[model samples]
Target: MKYKVCGRLGKNLKAGWLALVLSVLPAFVVADEPPEDPAHAHDPANVWFIGRGGQLYDSWMATTMAEKPWGNHPAYPAIGNKRGYPTWRCKECHGWDYKGKDGAYRYGAHRTDIKGVRGVLGMEPAEIQKIIMNETHAFTEDQLPHSAVEMLSYFLSFEQIDMDKYIDRRTKKALGDFDEGAHAYQSVCALCHGYDGKKINFASQKYPSYVGSVCARNPWQALHKIRYGQPGTGMVALSNVDLGIVVDILSYCQTLPEE
Candidate 1:
């Protein structure tokens, strides 16, 4: 899909802000310069996060679909209904699950016309971010603040994930050895998620089997949370954990009953 600016930053800005804007986007000239720094995870100008944020920004913001290129922009901004494209928020279309309607927002007005960013699994964070920042992608430099870019840096640098190797699509189980994953789960998740893998009650309306259910419905969602961590939840991303170990955990999760 062609990338177009849906919105621009507010006019009220200081010299630094204006400079940042210019540096982020120059008129007419499409420069494919790599990010300025690779080590700096907190700077938008950093190669790692900006690139990741760019992809993420694009995933939620840009439209490639020929049927609905706009991909259901929010007619109103308010959660229930306000004005000016309420659906513009990333959370609106993709749902908190990031698996799009296939996950949490499967039903409701927020239910939209596409899938989620979970397909980004296995891609390098920088590569993923590049897709987000591309003109035809979700985020435009003019549309977001430096902090937002930085936050994307944090996500791409620290949060975004790659799940392809971890899950077994055929058997719907994890594929790696489990020693480290066991240790991590016992240390961090056993109390709430439980040793039996049933504490989360994902099957019930009140609770769901975090592991079992996610694997059955969409393993990609599980992989994303494992990497980036869930928003507003106590769960944290496991960037330090080896992907092999994560696969072990998923393997175990696939063993659980769906109901």
Candidate 2:
């Protein structure tokens, strides 16, 4: 009689364990719920805003800190060396692509070693704009005008671009070609850079050499300058020119002497 009871009890125990497992099945099913997609994902409206913002920022960078570093105003000092608004241009730090030193300046003197905002894709817009106004980003809260700050912040908050894929380091060549680039340069850059592509003394005490100096040293920088127009100086953006024209200009400029 005892032996018979043991066999029956074992079967009952197995059945009880199975029932317990089945009872919690709903929890396991719920745990498998899908994870949330990135905040920027799938929404074309958001994409448009971010893209437009990015273009504006890049265009502004092209104007302010692009290659010249001292655009629109002759009196302004170098970006990193200066202590004012002209230096506060975003291109001075985060770069045209918003990648900062992590981007175009990864190895140059301007290199900041900072990460890109593109990395923080899901961050709140306010938080992103704050970063731009912060010392770590633009670093000119006091210098920047309220309207400038607000407008720049609005663009920065929405603008986000991944530039790592676009720029190349080894060849020092930007994303585009340098052949057609010559045409655009001739139209605008030729005046300053010169016909020989050996004009402008970027290193001189008074002015910078536009020739091969900047392009050879920093292609991405050259691209930014060409696209955005040097900050604090009279250099305005030639966005109308094809980016390929920029590359050609750089390629041709490289033939000039570094000294």
TM-score of each: 0.48, 0.54
What tens-digit string does per-residue lDDT give for candidate 2 at 1-259? 3544358888998899899999889666643221233444226554433333433354444432333333333322244443533344456556655676566656555555655555545455566567656654433433443444444554444333343444566676556455655565677777876776665666665555655777777666665556546545676554444445655666666656666
lDDT of 1 at 64: 20
* CA lDDT of every candidate: 0.51, 0.53
Q: After superposition on all CA atoms, what RMSD does each candidate show versus the true structure? A: 17.2, 12.3
Quick one: best TM-score, which candidate?
2
Over 99-198, each residue of candidate 1 has an lDDT whose tens digit, in order, gives 5646555565656545666665434556655665566435545555445545454453343433334555456456665565666666776776777567
